[model samples]
Target: MAIKPRSIFEEVSETQKPVAAPGGIDAKGRGARGAIRVWLMMLFALVVVMITVGGLTRLTDSGLSITEWAPLSGSVPPLNAAQWEAEFEAYKQIPEYTEQNAGMSMAEFKVIYWWEWGHRQLGRFIGLVWGLGFAYFLVRRQIPTGWTGRLVFIGALGGLQGAIGWWMVHSGLQEGMLDVASYRLATHLGLAFVILGFIAWYTFSLGRREADLMQARRAGDAGLVTLSGVLVGFALVQILLGALVAGIDAGRNFPNWPLMTTGTGASFFPPDPFSLTPIWRNFFEDAGLVQFVHRMSGYLLMAFAVFVWWRARRSPNTQTRFGFNAMLALMVVQMVIGILTVLYSAPVQIAIVHQLTAVVLWIAILRARFLARYPIAQSIRG
Candidate 1:
């Protein structure tokens, strides 16, 4: 006798049934895991937005407006004219206002103050959202075993980011410097990226069990992983260089691309890297060399991205291929933007877009690495 074919619903039901795990998560657990992953992704996107807005604040030279850090009280902006004048008076005492923005009115102060205020407000919002979501997940017991610690660690890092922001600001306030220290800027941006990467990795780790199995099956590509890691490293270095360039206003000096000047430029290489004396100075000071290094780093990053794409094109997996192509496209666009920003003396709009693109490219490469490492399984139907 011939057996009847199973209905699609039956097939799906069988597939969806929880598989016994040797200390691994079950089907019900997987649903919760997916939810957590979504929450993390959303949080990560918020962080990216914060970074973009922070870039805008920096570009507009509005980062130092508030001139004070009152984590709780600062969340509420000025409510009346008296409050506004009080805040403006505080800003006026800063060397930035006395020496650079002398005679600036309260209304003008409000423009920059609002941008800085918005940035800080966003940070607080993110903190509240994360705290509430995490607490809810914890109380519900939906948070996976061994993951709570990591979650708390990330939360602490967020707190640290707040502290670091003040520390960076303090550098400028104490020395009467108009701009923040390059090293502190690097530290701040680096931490932001680290938090971003952690969230991305956490999200990827929460994929379904079937997806984990697929990843296990295709885990022999060591070279690809290494290459991807190197690309990520390259991108990060480029970010640091860009930060330094911004800190020193280096882009203002070099308005030509592919060459330093209109015709044959000054020597392609500085006679002595030590010309900037005190190794730290070369990294943060010496505007000409800093800009030159940033430009060269961009070229290096583009070349590396292109090479990665070329190799990925030969991979059997469609996801890896797509990732490689996306990285290539992003690199090219980023390079063009970098050149344009330099040529045009880092116009605010273009500079902000450039910073935003860096975040986007960072996320894209991260996602690509994740997919390559953890290929998802196709659902089986009877």
Candidate 2:
């Protein structure tokens, strides 16, 4: 007699035993998303701190003290007096030492060396954190599908940033060069903003499940979407201009409000603006012209932020409106910090605060844009 074929339904019901509850995604999926999002947020905070530290290093005239990349060996730093003297002697050979800080003592040299070293050390730590966490999640199969490439892209950019940092520092070491090239500084900072923006967007995307994001798309406002995008692009340009200003020490040139002019003969425009050769080079190298552009850009950024805020107020989504409101507030505060930074001649304390405020503004804009793209659903009664 032929063996009776077991009933398919009976076999499935008895042996299959739920096979992951019918959906391709399971509860583990949500846990993984949450874990990854938290990890990204931590990285985001680290980067923000790193940016602030980088600014401080620049402000303190410490960026050029290291004079070497030495990515792996440099992490240990100088442990003995002889080692410290060796490091200081090496630093004395650079343009910044001979030209800008000729009389600096070994004690002072140590001060700057630590700043640059700390900045690099923090970067190394960030890389370690990202690498280890990513590998762990990937091995455990916790990273959600379709996200491996995006995650990998962030690490790649981060590694590129390290190289860019070294490149920025090298520009200062060349003969006759007192500081990093303004354009290279701008490039390094611009890439930082790009990385931060991507992290913010990714963090936002991960906050909600895939299904939730799909469902919320219908409710997203087109006007808000366009306006938010415009604001983000506008903010990035302003950041670049700000970087140009900082790179050239433009903020210390005029130290006036409402324009580049101050005191009795104060005028909004810089006097004798065509001092730089190549004509076009004045925009980046000339302190007077660079600050002039930065001031005007500030005005434009403020006006544009207002326009976006005005449109956002009319959005039906409460969260979206509140987000815009917060962004507008940050824009105002950031403007104040920028002005204060200028008036104080870009003092180390004030300048660092100004940079941190910029980071806050940058995050605020990203969050507002995220809300525009994936607005929170309000109750029908509200």
Candidate 3:
């Protein structure tokens, strides 16, 4: 006797019984996504902490502490009086200590020493977490083939960031400079943003896959994705300009927003007129111009975000509409934070928030982009 074919609903319900509930993803699948999402958020948070610690290290003039670059050995902090003295002696040989921190005792060295130590330790922890997490996913065969290559690429980028950090430090250790090269400072910050952007993109990708599997596509999807990508690009550029401003300590001079200095008119330009010559000098050495440019970039980014939101409102997709609105709100908050940071001369609390808000906005934009691209996929999964 031949068996009759089951109805589509009956077949689906049978499958659901084994792996997931009706209208829900499986427990294992949900758990995997949850773990990955948490790890990505943690990485983002760690970057913010690293940036804050770096700012403090700069403010305290502690970046050059423990001059030696013993990547393996330096992981262990000084444990005794003799070890502390040895570390202090290493620091004393650097120009920063001799020229700027001379006459400082071992006790004083300890203060700065700890800040640098904490920064390095955070870097190591990030490496370990990413490495172990990726291995776990790989062994379980849970990570999709499409994402495996990207994960490896990001892991390598993390390693490169470590090397770049030491390269930045090595500049100050060389003979002539009392502080790290401003250009190196800019590069270090630029790489941090790169890592951040990648993380935001990856997290958005995962979220998009889930959403696609849940919701069906509507209209204006392609335009929305394009707009999202544009917004993220603009935000990244603004972040780079902000790094330039920080590198030259530009915040110290232009404490006012909407104007370069406290004065009025064209005199507000850097005193030298052709002031920032050689192009390169303008980016790292010309404090006034750097800050001015950064302020202008912020305004540009805000305008772009608002425009994206306005266009998204016209789209038929509800999720895209919500994401665009989120992007718009974050943009406004970020602009306010940037102005406050400038007006406050980049105070530690405000400055760190400014940096963090940028990351948040990037993530929002990424979400919008992913939603737009995968609407159909989501509907099928649902």
lDDT of each: 0.80, 0.88, 0.75
Candidate 3's TM-score: 0.81
Tell me the number of clashing residue pairs for each predicted model: 0, 0, 9
Task: Write down the RMSD of candidate 2 (Cα, Å).
Answer: 4.5
TM-score to native of every candidate shown: 0.86, 0.91, 0.81
Ranked by TM-score from best down, the candidates are 2, 1, 3
Residue 160 in model 2: shift from native, Å? Answer: 0.5
Q: Please provide, for model 1 over 305-338, each residue's C-alpha lDDT reduced to its tens digit, 9 standing for 90 to 100.
A: 8787777776666666777778778878888898
Candidate 3: tens digits of C-alpha lDDT, residues 81-134: 999888888888888878888899877888989999998998888888889989
RMSD of each: 8.1, 4.5, 6.5
**Sort order, lDDT high to low:** 2, 1, 3
The worst-scoring run of ten residues by lDDT in candidate 1 lies at 373-382
Put down candidate 2 lDDT per residue, 1-382, tens digits, no spaces: 8998887677454465565564345344554899999999999999998999989888887888888889899999999999998999898898878877998988888898899999999999999989998999999988987889999999999999999999998998899899999889989998998998899899999988887787688888888889889899989889889889889788888877876664558887888788878899999888888888888888999999999999998988889999999999999999999989888899989888888888889989989988888888779876
